[model samples]
Target: MNFNQKELVKSTVPILKTNGTDLTKYFYRRMFKDHPELKNIFNMSNQASGKQQHALAGAVLAYAEHIENPEVLINVLKSIGNKHVSLNISPEQYDIVGFHLISSIKEVLGDTATDDLIEAWTQAYNELAQIMISIEEGLYQSNLKKSGGWKGWRAFIIADIVEESSEVKSFYLKPKDQDLIGDYLPGQYLSVKLFVPELGHEQVRQYSLSSAFNPEYYRISVKKEQNNSNSPDGIVSNLLHGKDKGDEIWVSAPSGVFHTSFATDHPLVLISGGIGITPLLSMLETNKNSLQENPTVWVHSCRNEKVHAFKEHINVLNKDSQWLTTHVFYETLSEKENTSVKEGRIDLSELKDEVLIDNAKYYICGPEVFIKVQYNSLINLGVAQEDILYEEFGPQLLHFN
Candidate 1:
């Protein structure tokens, strides 16, 4: 964008800070009203909870703040690009989003939206859109070139479902074509699209691949999100839980930036809270199977054993793998059966001797608040910022800086 356009977008920073969510909320409503089919690609549950709008608002504000140097936002953009690929977002969709976004800006800004201002934002949006499209194109091409990979959604049948816990179940999905499945990094996630009868539209949700790469099937451990006072029940997850074996669901190829590298033999620390253990399980398993005998630690926190998934599997791994160390914390323990298990929430300060391996890397996954707490704890323990990586379950909301 030109200097004038950059200046204009930057000038809107103050307004964006105050009315950003309103603008994005308006944009979504406007877009969905005109093109109802797009609803299939979005998570309406997050829309209802205002999370999608808030996340978009934050992203827009950040873009405006850094309009002069978009390169700085490349990492953030790549993260979003990974998510877009998982949802099978296409380049044509960008035109629709741009139209609605520009329209919302003008409508919300009222008479203050002059022609030059509109044009400026148009150029800015286009520039940012191009960057995203380019990034997504690269991701799409990479997936296509991979063995057993394809663009867009592919049909996958639930070959089997295993109960991991009272609330969590693992769905073993195999390609409907009976072809080999593409391999993915241990921490990557794939999107599942399902039709929701009550909502009268399809919903897409991403779940981490809970197992190491498999040629026959991809396993995703899902936690049934029960309705509560704070939020509505998870539509897709509940629908998945109700699905029978052999039922078909549309799945996108695995895509995510928060994956560990098997290239290095560095000691690794994997920490998780509640249902966040899904991705970490893959990492632990992959590490166990790797030729390198890197010392690895698994630290998990959950309510109790009843809701804890993969307990026996982890125990067997712990027992068999000399390089693997395990630690568990239950908010309320039913019984003191294991010496490695503790009572109450995760306290890194207490696990200093266990988790504070020299030159080890830390990977955390959990709810927004839980991730923040663990991130801060790691910082307090003097872990380098660059050494710690995290993946939030929903919209990116955690800001460590």
Candidate 2:
């Protein structure tokens, strides 16, 4: 964009700060009204919860704030690009979004929407759209070049479903064509699209792959989200839970940037809370067979043993691998267990000697609050900011200084 356009976008920072969410909410409503078919690609549950709006508002605000130098936002853009690619977003869809977004801005601004302001925003939005399209296209091409990978969605059959816990179940999926599946990073996730009879539309949700790379199949562990007063039921998750063996579902190739490298010999610390263990389980499984002498520690927290998925599997791993150490913390203990079990929330202070090794890398996965608490605790314990990586299950809303 030109200098004037950049300045104009930067000038809207104050307005975006004050009414960003409202603007995004209006934009989404207008877009959905005009392009109803797009509902199949977006997560309606997040829309109803206002999470999509807030996430978009924050992203837009950040873009405007850094309008003068968008290069700095490349990492953020790449992350979003991965998500868009996983949802099978196309370049043509950006045009529709741009139209509705610009219209929403003009409609919401009313008399203040001068010709110059609208023109400036149009140019700015077009530039950003092009950038995103380019990123997504590159991602699409990368996936296509991978072995056994294809663009867009592919049909997969649920070969089996195992009850991992009271709330969590593992779905073993294989390609409907009975062909070999592509390899994905241990911590990456795949998008699953399902038609919800209750919503009268298709909903797409990304679930972390819970197992190591396998050419035959992919496994995803899903925790059913029960309906509550604060939020509606997880439409896609509930629908998936009700699905029977041999049911077919549409799945996108795995995509994410939150994976770790098993090529290194550094000590690794994997921490998770509740169902967040899904991705971390993949990391642990992939790293367990490594011939390196580096140690790996698995720390998990949940309500109790009944809801703790993969307890036996983890126990077997702990017993067989001398390089693996395990710890479990329960919010409320039902009975006295072994040395690995403790009663309370996760406290890094208690495991300092085990986790504070030299050049140790920390990977945390959980809710936003849990991530923040653990991140801050790690910082307080003298871990470098760059050494700690975390992944939140939902939108990328967490900001750290």
Candidate 3:
């Protein structure tokens, strides 16, 4: 944890950067072999896709790359903090991961892994783990300070359940004690933990808060992954789909960076694709009573009416709020619906031609491909990159650029 340790790790970062994937693969292989108990800790499906390995490797490389500027890695570490919390990744687990990571480096590097080199990586891993542990500890404290709060994860009774669509469902959760809850920022997400027998332990996934933050209960809208019935199915989403009223599920306090602050007079443009509408809807609801001068434009894209999650709710908000304007685009629709719902997705040309108003802050959240392509397009359309905010769903999707 010494400065020299970070410096040592920094010196060898280039080599680690080049072999990041190999290192991560080695790390995971050794981890699962030595501590097979961790098999339940990671998402096997993502590991199979090579996404998780690449993601962890990318982060370690970034840490080395930014060793001199650790402050710059705060956001990156914060995102990781959120993911770790959701995954139930504890401080103890960090030791497990760190132990094997160093071992992997020694095994892979062989003759190159001198005593000094090993010490450097050991210290670097400890430092990095400390940062994550501290951030996560702060998060735990924040959640615990609330009226109805607990550390780690706890079972919450399902106060109510509403069906949003054939594929999507909404769950209203309240602590078993039935006490008031702390308010969360609009556009934040909550991690629900489900104990899937097949998956073992518990698996976590993030779902955006569909309803405005209320002190009484939290609402999360989820789309069941029905795309592959032949597969085992989505761990959290599937578990949520079958549960009914009066059931119990574990809930974490809402946490995310994407938020709508009416404190600023800046104009706002909220864009979403598919079920990404959840967070935007929360933003609109939170701003419904605001008297801000700048307008808030919501442009949402979906396949059609059947799968669209919050059409009626959005329509009602549009009627009630004058500062809000709703623009709907359906990719595959009837000729009339296509004209009514502004056909296709939101792109650079579409923003330039249709979405007007400058000096506005843009907030986007959705699938990896959609958010990335649209975010880049917005920059191409002359929007300042600094003013744009986004939150990706999983740990693998890093938006450094």
**TM-score against truth, every candidate:** 0.98, 0.97, 0.91
Scored by TM-score, the top model is: 1
Winner by lDDT between candidate 3 and candidate 2:
2
Pick the winner on TM-score between candidates 1 and 3.
Answer: 1
Query: 164-189 in candidate 2: lDDT tens per residue?
Result: 99999999999998877888887899
Better of 2 and 3 by TM-score: 2
Best by lDDT: 1
- Model 1, residue 39: C-alpha shift (Å): 0.8
Weakest lDDT window of 10 consecutive positions for candidate 3: 285-294
Rank candidates, TM-score, best first: 1, 2, 3
lDDT of each: 0.91, 0.89, 0.78
Candidate 3 on 1-401: residue-level lDDT in tens?
56776778888778877888888988898998888777655777677767888999889988888877878989878977876775567889888898899999999999999898898888778888999999999887887897665666667888898887667788898887676666777888777767778766656667888887777788988888764655656667778889988998777777777787634477778888888888877887777645553578888887777788877888887787778777887777776553557766765565575555777888887788888887888877888778888877666565644
Candidate 2 regions exceeding 4 Å error are none
Name the lDDT of candidate 3. Answer: 0.78
Per-residue lDDT for 1-401 in model 1, tens only?
78887899999999999999999999999999999999998888788889989999998999999998889889889999999999988889999999999999999999999999999999999999999999999999999999999888999999999999999999999999998788999899999998889988888999999998878899999999999987778888889999999999999999998998654479999999998999988888787677785899988999888999999999998898899888899988765556567988899988888989899989999888888889999999999998899999888866553
Collision count of model 2:
0
